[model samples]
Each structure stands twice: as C-alpha cells, then as structure tokens.
Target: MTESTEPVKINKWDGAAAKNAIDDAIREVLTGDLKCKESFALIDGRLFLCALAVGVALYALLWDYLYPFPQSRLVLIICVSSYFVLMGILTLYTTFKEKGIFVVAKEKVGNVTRVWEASSYVKKHDDKYNLVLVLREPSGKTREASINKTFANYIDSNGTIVQNLVASEVTKLYNSLSSEKKEK
Candidate 1:
C-alpha cells in the first residue's frame, strides 16, 4: 500500500494501538531490506565454507605437531568445533548489527525535522513496552530515559500512527515548556 503524506490523527489511537504501530514500523525498518531469505542463506553458506577450510588446516597443523587429540578423531573434532565457532561469531555479529540498525531507525522515526526537543522509540520486553526517550536540550546535550508502559491488544501496520504520536507528544511538550516560560 502507498504511504500517506498526511499525518495520522493521534486522538483516535489508544495506547496499545500506538505501541503496536511503532513496533511494526521498527520491524519494517529492521528487515525491509535484502528482499528475500536467499541473501541470508547465501551469507551463512559462504561463512560455513570458510570456517570448514580454516578448521581443516588448523586441525592438520595441530595433529602434525602438538597432536592435541587422537588422529582418528581429527575430522569429527574439527567439524564440531568449526560449527560452534561459526555460530558464536555469527550470533555476536548479528546482534550488534541489528542493534545499530534499530537505533538508527528509532532516531529516524522519532525526530521530526529536529523540531522536537528530543526523539523516542518503543522497545518491547516480555509483555511490556519500554519507551526510550532521548532528550536533547538547547545546550547541545542529550539524555536518555527508558520508561516502562503497559499496552494491550492493538495493531497498526503503517508507521504513520507512531510517527504522528511522537510528533504530537513533542508538540505538547514544547507547548507546555513555552507556557511555563511565559508564566515565569
């Protein structure tokens, strides 16, 4: 479906719906690229091949000199160790990469033309939602807060709802600050 240029109205959205909408948007940003599963499969395939070659060479060298284990078990040992190492490395790499992508997506979705004093994103932990709000002051400093909020059943596929919600929240914050300044 085509994305709407118009801002989504926040008044109609319940808290759960808004949180779901944000989560959907973040998921899209996380996996929208690469198009198909083949890309990932291909990556793992190449890594496996490389790991196998390294494992074989290392095992041969050790068997010839150190003889770390029984010669008969070289193949089995190398294969199992290589597999574990490959999995461990991939796990770490994927975790860090995905996290970086998540942070970038959150920053992109939360900041509205730099008008808002800060930006925010929702992170799901177990059954709860944690709103990670980053506050940027006029002094060019920043602070982050993770506020846990409860949300129930709701769904919104498009990102517009979450975007609008953030904008609305920022606007309200700005208005409140302005009023406070005036009163002072």
Candidate 2:
C-alpha cells in the first residue's frame, strides 16, 4: 500500500484578507477600556486645535482690550501649560501600565526595514476549525498567514503554541531575508 499525501491549499488573496482582519483586530484592541489613553489623546488633540482656533479668533476680536492686560496673557499661558501637564500625567500612567503580549520582529527586505507585530487565534466556521494569524505594523501595513485545522488532542489554552508559532515564523522570515541580502 502506498501512502497518500494531499497537496496543501493556499489562498491567493490571504494577504489582503488578513490585512483587513488585522485592521479589525487592531481597532478592537485600541478601543478597549484599557487602551483609553490613545482615545483620550485623539480627543484632547482635537480639542486643543479647537481651543487654539477660538483663542486666535478671540485675540483678534479683543486685541484692543487684551493688549493692555498682562493677566490675559498669563491666563493663556496657564491654559496651554495645563494642557501639557495633563498629557504628561497621562503618559506617566500609561508607562506604568502593564503592556500587552505581542510577538514582535524586525526584518529588512531589500532596502526597507519592517517591524511586525503578530497574533493568532483559532475560529470555527461551518463545523470546521481554522487558525487565523495577523502580522501588522503600527503604520497599518499588514501580512497574514494561516493554517487549516488538523485533528488535535487539545487546543493550547495558554496561547503558548500560538506565540511559539509566530516567533518561529518571524525568525524564519528574518533569517531568510538576511541570507538573501548577504547573497546579493
């Protein structure tokens, strides 16, 4: 009897699909309660811009009265200084917070250096299972890889398998690219 080996299935559009999925995941991560600092920064930034515009307009309208009063200048100074102080406090808080677990890697392909953050999870669909992976950069560039589910005694509950898989792939990618660069 001959052993049968089935050819693997590869999705041509996996990169694009994974990019979209990674974006969704990143959005979910960023909007969670623990990630409020990013949201606060965005809101505060817009507010600062609006305040600047209002201050400019007010200054124009009240140029005559404002020019004579040193206290008005002092108040403006205090407001701007206070905004910076608040942001500093928030930054300190975030610095002290526990960071998220991520598998991070750096690879240089050609002349461009890439930093990748990767994560993986399993999902079920139509009574079947799939392992989904997302690798993305802070700048929104993404790539994806996946594995079709196979029979297992148990899925890893502690995420050790997933993290190891990501780390292995990242290492392989970086080594391959570095070797290629050396060959050239």
Candidate 3:
C-alpha cells in the first residue's frame, strides 16, 4: 500500500519479479515514479486542453495588438481565435494519433501472436487478476494491430507508466521463454 521512496537500489532491473511489482503497485499504490522520472500518477487529459487554452489567450493578445481600431478589433479577434482554434485542434489530433501505449503478451494467441511494441486499449476484466488489451494504432484507424499478452503486473491503473520494460528486462523474459520452450 506504500510506495518505495527509499530510492531505487539497482540501475538495471532484471525481469525477476517485475510482474508482481507492477501488479501490486497498480492495485494499491496511488503514485509512482517512472524511469525518466515522469509521473503518470494520473492520466490527466488536461495537457492538450491547457495548451489549447494558452494558445487561444496568446492569439487574443495578438489580435489586440493588430487592431488599433475598436471596430476592426472585433473582426481580428474572431479571425485570430478561429485560426488558433484550428491549429490547436490539429495539434491535439496529431499528438493523440501517435502510439503512446504498448501491450506485452504472455502467451501465443494465434499463429502470429507475438509481443512487439504496439498501441492498445486496455481494460480490467471482471477477473481483475487478468487484463484484456485490445491493440490498436494511435491513428484511431480501422486497420488492425497486432495482439499481445501481458500479465497483471506491468500496469498500474493508479501509477504512471515508465518507459515500457527496460532492455534488460525484455532480454531476460525472452531468454526465460526460450528456455521454457526448449524444455517443453
């Protein structure tokens, strides 16, 4: 229930208990620190909204400067507002259109089941122990995306997301899975 502010003792993370760490933090922890120290503690969509608001306000200031005449001031204000509004809309669309989320798979789903870096829509299933991640491109396009699996450990509906797993973690998982396959 408490977060470890005790400081990260390791510079590198081995994939030993990452799943358990991620799962426990997501369920009970309210805040977390990511690799770059970026806090995803809250998934606030206000970022875009704030940028848009600032842009609009700046455009208003510009409009006032451009129009010394009160009669023309109204027209310029409307035009500048409209232009900034369009630009802001485009900016938000482009940012949200990029792949900002990824899914990691645990097992093979179909013939092509593999966990590569891809965007997705994740939901906590009725069995909170398991999560369902529906992969989709950030373009919000109708085209299909590759499906992958991840156990409950990596996601913290409550914590901020760190850079996906580190390189060492991926290597560890791959090696473990490969060995397990050889055994089977």
Candidate 4:
C-alpha cells in the first residue's frame, strides 16, 4: 500500500472574514461563556477615596497659610483645581478605554482559567488570525495569540464568516480541567 504524499491544504482566513471571526469569537466568549461585564465601580470608588483623602489632607495643612498670604491661597486653589480636573479627565478616559471586550474563563472551583481583554485585531498570518490581547492576570500583561481559523463556522448576514474560535478554545480548556480533576 502506498501512503498519500500530498500535504493537507489549509484555508486562509483574511480581511473582513478574519475580522468578523475574531470579533464573533471575542463576543461569544465574553458574552456567553465568560459572562464578563464591564465595570467601572472599583476604579470609580478608588478614585473617589483618593480624592477625598487628598482634599482632607490639603485642607488641614493649608488652612494655616491661607490667611497669611492671600495670593498663596489663590495659587493653592488653582493647583488643587487643576489636579482635580486632570484626575477627572483621566478617570473618564480610563472608563472609556476599558469598555472593550473582556473574556474570563474560570476553573471548576472558580479559579481563574484565563483573563484577557481584546484590544484590537493585529493581522492574519497563514491559516491563523492574530489579535492584540491584554492579559489582566499576572499584572496586566499584553500578548498576541494566533487563532486558528478552522473553528469558525457561522456566516453572518453581511456575507462574512463569524467564528467563535476563542469560545471553542475556552471550552477545550474547561474540558481539560475537568479531565484533570477526574484523573486526580
């Protein structure tokens, strides 16, 4: 018997199809499996506490100098106001910046399986799609992963193939964990 020598052909996913697949994967993992909800409560609470502390400290220290120098009071007021304005701007920016897709898969006992935020689509290489992912665990690490395009199946109304490759990957990871637990 002769063995076939032809190499297997892999379909390349690029352009709109790749983007749509990646987007769908991110959306499915985030919405369906991961169930990650965008939250600014923690950040907003921290900022509020910090602002309160700073305001109290400033009032206590500057009260003595305010009456002595009228110009000094004005300068202090300007500095404090500017600081608050800057902080407000930064808080708003952060709120908006963190609104992107966040995927979080957990182990059986609620341990973190994976935590990544999809920043943007990078590029397509060979039969895979590259995405810029911000890993939230292990200290906000940023990395890229080449997602295989073979997992995508759904075709959207716009004629683009929507892939849930990430969701499939997460499901694989979850199954692996279950198997490991069974082995133990």
lDDT for predicted candidate 4 compared with the true structure? 0.48
lDDT of 1: 0.43
**What is candidate 2's lDDT per residue for 1-184, written digit by digit as tens?**
0133222222323443333333333333322311211223333654565576566556544753756556467655655576566566556543443122223334444566455343334343321224333444445666555445321211133211232333343345444533553575
Best by lDDT: 4
Single out the weakest 10-residue window by summed lDDT for candidate 1: 30-39
Which sequence of candidate numbers ranks them by lDDT, best first? Answer: 4, 1, 2, 3
- Write one digit per residue (lDDT tens) for candidate 1, span 1-184: 1255454434323555565555544333322331111124324654675677677667666665654456547665666676677767667765553332222221232333111222233444443555443333444655554445443322234324544443343344445543553475
lDDT of each: 0.43, 0.40, 0.39, 0.48
Clash counts for all predictions: 0, 0, 6, 0
Please report how far candidate 4 places residue 78 from its true position, in Å: 2.5
Models 1 onward score TM values of: 0.34, 0.24, 0.30, 0.34
Listed per candidate, the RMSD to the true structure in angstroms reads 11.2, 16.2, 12.1, 12.8
Cα-based lDDT at residue 118, candidate 3: 23
Task: Give candidate 4's TM-score.
Answer: 0.34
List candidate 1 segments past 4 Å from native: 5-21, 26-76, 93-127, 133-143, 152-163, 166-184
Tell me which of candidates 1 and 2 scores higher on TM-score: 1
Q: 9, model 4: CA deviation in Å?
A: 29
The global Cα lDDT (0 to 1) of model 2 is: 0.40
